[model samples]
Target: MRLEGRTAVITGGTRGLGRAIAEAFLAEGASVVAAARNPYDIKELADDHEGRLLYQYTDVTDERSVEELMTAACEAYGGVDILVNNAGVSRDGKIARLSVADWNTTLATNLTGVFLCTRAVIGPMTTPGKPAGPGGRIINVSSCVAGRAAVGAGAYSASKAAVEMFTRTSAVELAPKNIRVNCLSPGYIDEGMGKELAANERAWESYRGRLLSDRLGRPEEVGAAAVFLAGGESSYVNGTVVEVNGGLLWAA
Candidate 1:
């Protein structure tokens, strides 16, 4: 139980990578606060695991909503020890044909959401009388597209890139407070953000040949890496980007 007695909040934890992270944390003995817009089916999940889990409907893009999420999490769990910013979206279109509304929306949810969640939780992570741990962890879930100038994903890519920069900035600022900030940028994962690409059988076959692992990574693998970042294993690791791309983005 690497995270025994820790309290964690994961945005977008109702599904995909976020959901997997919540499960992983719970398995590691952490009490989790899962926040997302979707109302969670708590009964089924609670039955599956004999551990503590709370869900709050949250729009991460909204400051007030994010603040309320933090308040509820801290009140319920005592304090926040780890935060995983995993709320994001994608809108694919050519640059010439892209709509400003779509671009702004992507930035709002992907980038601004991270900022809102981080800001809302930072105080609890830093303030005293909170029983989280000796230090705190903030892991921003980014994408491999942030490192590559791939075609047809300008808005999504740029938003993720900005998130990385934000991560570095947060690490530098929060270091004095004993909180570490890092980014996890996965490449062509089989579940979560890459589901659309993986849904195409032909695309998976072609993609398998390119990947060093000969297959797309799974959401649980990302969850495992996230656990490492959140636990004491990554104590000295700070202001860095962990590439969970399975050699697909060797350039990163």
Candidate 2:
């Protein structure tokens, strides 16, 4: 177990990519706190993982809630060795048609949430003599749209692009504290938001040819990449955006 004894706090861990990451971490023997606004079926995960898993109700958009999540994780597992800011929301609309409410919602959950969660974990992760490891990991989840443009994705794209920049800046600032920050930019996959897109046959057909793999990416693949970032295997990796997009070509 590469992550044996390590403790990871994952935001939005109740479903989709976050759930996949949680399962992968547990398999590697890490204690996981799955924080989300809703618990959903995470109790089932708790049943399977038992002591190794915790489901904490968290609203990442609220600083207080984020802080409470960190506190709960520490109280339960001692301290956090890894923090995955995987919670996000996408509100798609063309600029002229996009409501201000939609824009605010997207930025609040996608960008501000990452900031709050990262801030909440910094102290515990960097504190001297803490029960956690000497160096901690912070993995921010971004989207492929962060680096590419698509019609109707203005707000989501902008927020994620900002997240990538934030990740780099955080990595530089936290480096001296022995905390490494990185971003994972996932392209269209077969789970989570991508699953919804794939449901629209017209949309799926239009995008399918862009992927060199000729198929949608599996959640497990993303999970494997997350494990590497959270484990010792990525000791030298920091401040980088690892794109998990199966060689996707950006359509002009």
Candidate 3:
């Protein structure tokens, strides 16, 4: 196992893309702390992985809860080796009519949560004598919409766009600490949020033809990409956004 003996804290790891990443990490022999606001039927997953998995209640939007998550990881697994900032929310609305509440909600979770989790993990990950492995990794999840134009996706796009820049900045800042920060941007995937979109026949039809692969991406595909970034094989890779979108050809 490439990730044997390492411990990773994954925010929003309860479902969707986050869950996929958690599964991948577990398969690679890493101890995973699946941080999410709700348990969301994770009992079975925890049962399967047993000691390798932990479900911690974390509200990434709140500083206290995020800190507690780190503490929990440290207590349960000795220290944090990798962090996947996969927690996010999307609020769709045209620019003019978007409510302030919606905008704030989007930014608070998508942007601020990434910041909080990244900052909180620094202590545990870098602390001496507490590492499960060569500890230092952070993966931020963004979306293709961040760089493209999508009608009624102003707030959502803007928040993710900000995350991409944040990822770059964090990579530079955390370099001296030996932490490699990177971004994973997935396009139309048939899971979680993407699944919801693909459910809309009209929307799916429009997006389907634009994809070079001509099909929705699978969750395991995104999981595989995450595995590369978290593993030692990508030791030289950092501060880059790896697109997991099945060759999505979208300008808007």
Candidate 4:
């Protein structure tokens, strides 16, 4: 119960890495609000965790929707002590083939959403008198591809690279407010996008050699890293990008 009594708001917490992080936080005794455009069977999670979990419909790209999410979280669990900007979308296409729409959508969700959600949570997390305890935590989710170049990952990679820089900037600005911000850059995992990639034998074989572990990472592994970042264990850690990859070797 490292997170006992803490309140966390996770964007896109209904599935994939976000869902895994939600479950991990709940296990550590945190009250969580999972925000996404759709519930996507998150009711099952609510049922299992009962009072500890709440699902809110949120479109992170919209400012009003994000404000409502933070407001609702405050009303339900008092105030948010931790925030995870985990919402993202991937529209893979080569530079020449990628459409403006695909690039726009990818940036809107992957980069802009993080900006909005983080901005909205600042006030609540740093309420003058309330003082959310020792301090607040903000975890921005990035991808391993942020620093690696791939054939059809232009938009996704660009958006994520910007996110990592944004994480650093946020950390610097929010440090005075006692808010610690960090980025979690996950490598190919066994679920979500990684699962889709692994399904393609040719793609999997090509990328398999890059992983030092010689296997895809587990969702729980990413979730565990999230827990560490949000918990007291990482009090001194901030403005750093924690790579949860199984040691991916990128070619020059």
Best by lDDT: 4
Tens-place lDDT digits, model 4, residues 1-252: 999999999999999999999999999999999999988998998898889999999999999999999999999998999999999998988899899999999999999999999999999988878854769999999999899888899999999999999999999999999999999999999998899989999989998988888899999999999999999999999999999999895422
lDDT by residue for model 3 (1-252), tens:
888888999999999989999999999999999999998988899999989999999999999999999999999998898899999998889999999999999999999999999999999888976644444989999999989889999998999999999999999999988899999999988897788878999988988887888888999999899989998888899999999887884433
Best of the two (1, 2) by lDDT: 2
TM-score of 1: 0.94
Q: Judging by TM-score, tell me the better candidate of 2 and 4.
A: 4
In candidate 2, the residue pairs with backbone N, CA or C atoms under 3 Å apart (3 or more residues apart, or in different chains) clash, namely none
- Report every candidate's CA lDDT: 0.88, 0.92, 0.91, 0.94
Assess the local accuracy of residue 11 in candidate 1 as a C-alpha lDDT between 0 and 100: 92
Give candidate 1's error at residue 36 in angstroms.
0.3
**TM-scores of the models, in the order given:** 0.94, 0.97, 0.96, 0.97
Task: Point out the higher-scoring one by lDDT: 2 or 3.
Answer: 2
Compose the digit string of candidate 1's lDDT tens values, residues 73-173.
88887888999999998998989998999999999999999999888888989877664466999999999889888789999999999999999999999
**Ranking of models by TM-score:** 4, 2, 3, 1
TM-score of 3: 0.96
**Compared with the true structure, what per-residue lDDT tens digits does model 2 show for residues 52-105?**
999999999998999999999989988889999999998899999999999999
Ranking of all predicted structures according to lDDT, beginning with the best and ending with the worst: 4, 2, 3, 1
Best by TM-score: 4
